[model samples]
Target: MAIPKVFITRRLPEKCIKPLQQVAEVKMWSEEYKPVPREVLLQEVQTSHGLLTMLSDRVDETLLAQAPQLKCVANLAVGYDNIDLEACRLHHVIPCNTPDVLTETTADLVFALLMASGRRLIEANDYLKQGKWQEWGPFLMAGADIHHKTIGIVGMGRIGTAVARRAQGFAMNVIYHNRRRNVEAESELGARFCGFESLLETADFVVNLIPYTETTKGLFNQNAFTKMKKTALFINAGRGATVDEDALYQALLEGEIAGAGLDVFSQEPIPKEHPLLTLEQVVALPHIGSASVETRKQMISLCCKNLMRTLAGEKPITPIETSR
Candidate 1:
């Protein structure tokens, strides 16, 4: 029997490709670090039986319509906002994402960003690098206190619960707001469920872990920033679309909030002219939430496994249920 063809959108770790190659004819774009162009992706999908893609690729209806032999799309990340689900369903393409694997890793990054922003770590580092630290003054490099403060988690899912657990270590109070309260999470983590407004009003530090959905798109606007305390630090480890970038820029410029740490952005590779880039209070990262060597390897392996199983007519280990 002829083996099926699999096209990986970008270059992945050798371990991830090895497993897939065992079952299919794998063709990977040699340049893994950069995003594959749209024209190239469309051309590759034409003859592929399965596609392994990352968040960078926008798998829309037009691309789906061209892939007659495509059986499954295994997204390497947890979020699926880049891919059009309705188009997948219409084309009978199975859409899958790697969830649980990166939950803890992402949570760790959230806490890291929260602490770094709250304490002005980056700013202080710059001060030292610029040879400006002549001597330590009584009030030099002062930042907000993190311990024993209230932390408000915007979304109480797996990543949220993980972040709350870490907060407990600092003797901090964990308050959260979700679509619906998870009684089990409350009991296990001692997480207090509150309304969205209350969470913003009471938290000393606000952490956004909500996934990007139709309802959550542009959820964090000027009004939301205005609701937070002036001393409150904001951290985002979730999808960038959840925030209105322009509104956030205005809030920061106007001192609506103290500081912010952003892992993702409205646009990847944010332009040099972007207003947010000019802010001193913002600590920006290039979306490395699951960049840990071990975690990334696992995520890639899972995506390849999901693709192989779905193509082989076997149930995928982590199949995304559209009904939910």
Candidate 2:
């Protein structure tokens, strides 16, 4: 009998690949930075039994239709928006994501970015590096304060709850808006449930942790930004498309909102000339939410294990519900 085959979209650790190798023939795209070309990925799925993909890869209806033998997809990141879950269900393909393992790490990054933007950490460092820190004034690099301020989290999942815990340590008032109320988060974290519009108006720091979905796409348009206080800070650690990029830029430009700290953008590796990058008030990162060393290794391990389990006629470790 021919060994089952698995195609990995990007290079993973040798140790992570070893276990998959024992059960199947493994093929990997050797680059770490470049995404596998769409044509190449389609060609690979023709015969592969399982696929290990990253957020950069698109596993859509068109690709799924061509992959007759493919049984499982283990997405390395916690978000599976890149994959078409409905298509997977129609094709009888199981999709899994590396969640829980990266929640704390991502939450850590959210707080880091919040602090960086609120306190002007990056701007201050650049000022000193440019030899422009000759003298100090009372407000030389002064920025917003995090303590005892209201923080309205847009999503209340594992990562959101973790972020609320961090907000607690800072003594910030935690409020949240979710599709459904999360009682545990309310009781344990002292989070108050509120409507989306209300949250926007009241929160001193408006943080978005919501996942991307059809309903959430372009949710933060001009109207949403206009509703926020001119003194409010906007932070997004969630998917980029959730907020309208153009609207966000205008908000920063017009002082409709104070500033923004964004880890994800509508386009990855945003162009240097992108309007958002030009603003001193905008703190942009390259979507490194779960990028801690230990968390990355754990995500890889979870993804590999999920793929292996699904191929061996067992359930995936963190299967996504296609019914949504």
The candidate that wins on lDDT is: 2
lDDT string for model 2 (1-324, tens) is 778999999987888678889999999998988899999999999999999998989999999988999999999998889999889999999999988999999999999989998999999999999999998899999999999999999999999999999999999999999999999999999999999999999999999999999999999999999999999999999999999999999988999999999999988877889999999998999989999889888888888898889988998889998886
In candidate 1, stretches whose alpha carbon ends up further than 4 angstroms from where it belongs are none
Candidate 2 clashes: the total is 0
Q: For residue 198, give model 1's deviation from the true position in Å.
A: 1.0
In terms of lDDT, the poorest run of 10 residues in model 2 is 11-20
Number of clashes recorded per candidate = 1, 0
Instruction: Please estimate how well model 1 matches the true structure, expressed as its whole-model Cα lDDT.
Output: 0.90
Cα lDDT listed for each candidate: 0.90, 0.93
TM, every model: 0.97, 0.98
lDDT string, candidate 1, 181-264, tens digits: 978779987899999999998999999988899899999999999999988888988889999999988888899999999999
The numbered model that scores best in TM-score is 2
